[model samples]
Target: MNFGTKAVHAGVTPDPSTGAIMTPIYQTSTYVQESPAKHKGYAYARGANPTRNALQKSIAALEDGKFGICFSSGMGATDAVIKLLAPGDEVITSNDLYGGSYRMFRKIYEKFGIKFHFIDLTDVNNITPFLNEKTKLLWLETPSNPLMRITDIKALTTIAKKNNMLVAVDNTFASPYLQNPLALGADIVMHSVTKYLEWP
Candidate 1:
């Protein structure tokens, strides 16, 4: 099915017990088990919840990825990805990025020994000099916040791949509707669902 069809029906189906068409929110904290080793899918809310799983599965399907993990907030997701970089690993990122991301990378991650260098990603040439073995991640924020500057994802991905670096794109502005970074060769794509996906 196309993206539009998948968006509407990919992660949800009729409930087997009640025959409800919409995906019901599984709001409980825990699920009962027939035995200690054998269970009925869910164990705890923190690890997994039916509602959250639906959302995560939908997102992963939309992005054409194998897995999806939802977090309490966008920063939570960002922090999780950054954690993949060990202490003293370098990250090459855009100079004009979201303030929250900047704080996370510069203030928080730096304290943990993760170093970041912000450069003009629009001019792919400027980023080339910074690519090296130590660089673990290439963080891209296209159509950047406040400034709305667009970067060439394909070009950046090429550079990142050459150095065997992971490429993460902040897709909040353009969104999956306007942009799909994974199709353009990005390793990871993030969104601020609170903004366009959920806000009224």
Candidate 2:
């Protein structure tokens, strides 16, 4: 299906009980069960929700990704990605990217010992100088925040893969309709749903 068709129908199914055409807002914090071991796929709001599951599926389909995980905010999703690294691991990213992401890298994760190299990514060759065994991830933001600089995703991801580094692209600025980083060889792709998609 095209983006428009997938956007509307990809992960949603009609409610069998009410025959509602859209996934209903599962507002309750918990679900009922026949027994302690038998229940529908949710336990608590913090863990999962039917409404969120539908949204995740729609996003995954849009990105041509295997799965999608929703977060309260874009930063929350970013924090989850960074948590994959341990102390002493490193990341390479563009200096022209999002300010919130920059602050999160420099202020929050740096103290945790995850070193980030902020450089000019417009010239993909600039990333070569920072390549090292310590680098565990390559983060990219195309049509980047504020400056709106574009980075060549396929070119940079190719180089990153050669070094065995996982590549992640913050696609909030470009949106899935404009670019799908996973198809370009990024291991992970992130989006702030509130930005272009405009829904949780």
Candidate 3:
């Protein structure tokens, strides 16, 4: 299906109980089970919810990715990505990225020993001096927050991959409708759905 169709129906199904056209909002925090250990896919709202699952499916479909995971906020998503690294690992990212992300990198993770190199990713070559065995991730924010500077996702991913670095793009500005970073060789793609992907 095309983008328009996928946006409407990709990860959604008619309500099985009521035959409702869209997945109903599953508002309960807990699910009833036949036994203490037996239940359908969902058990707790904190763990999973049908509504959120549908949204994740739609997002993954739009991005041409195999899976998508939702977070309470964009920073939550970024934190999860950064947690994939250990102390002494390094990340190379655009200096023009979202302010909240910058602060998180500097204040929170830096103290943990994950060095962040904030550089002009718009030139791609600026990333070279930072490349090394310790560099584990290449983070990009296309049409970067505030400044609206566009980074060359494919070009940067190519160089990053050569050095065995995982690439992640914060696609909030461009959104999946305009750009699919995974297709450009990024290992991960993140979106603040409350931004461009918000339902009308």
lDDT of 3 by residue, 1-200 (tens): 98888888898988777998898988989988889869887789999898999889888999999999999999999999999999999999988889999999999999999999999988978988899999999999998999999989999999999999999999998988888899999999998877885433
Report the number of backbone clashes for model 1.
0
lDDT accuracy of residue 128 in candidate 1: 74
Looking at model 3, which ten-residue stretch has the lowest summed lDDT?
Answer: 191-200
Predicted model with the maximum lDDT: 2
lDDT of 2 at 35: 89
Cα RMSDs of all predictions?
A: 2.0, 2.1, 1.7
Q: Between which residue pairs do clashes occur in model 3?
A: none
Q: How many pairs of residues collide in model 2? A: 0
User: Once model 3 is optimally superposed onto the true structure by TM-score, how far is the C-alpha of residue 62 displaced, in angstroms?
Assistant: 0.7
TM-score of each: 0.94, 0.96, 0.96
Off by over 4 Å in 2: 197-200
What is the C-alpha local distance difference test score of candidate 2?
0.92
In terms of lDDT, the poorest run of 10 residues in model 2 is 191-200
Write down the lDDT that model 1 would get: 0.86
Measure candidate 3: CA RMSD: 1.7
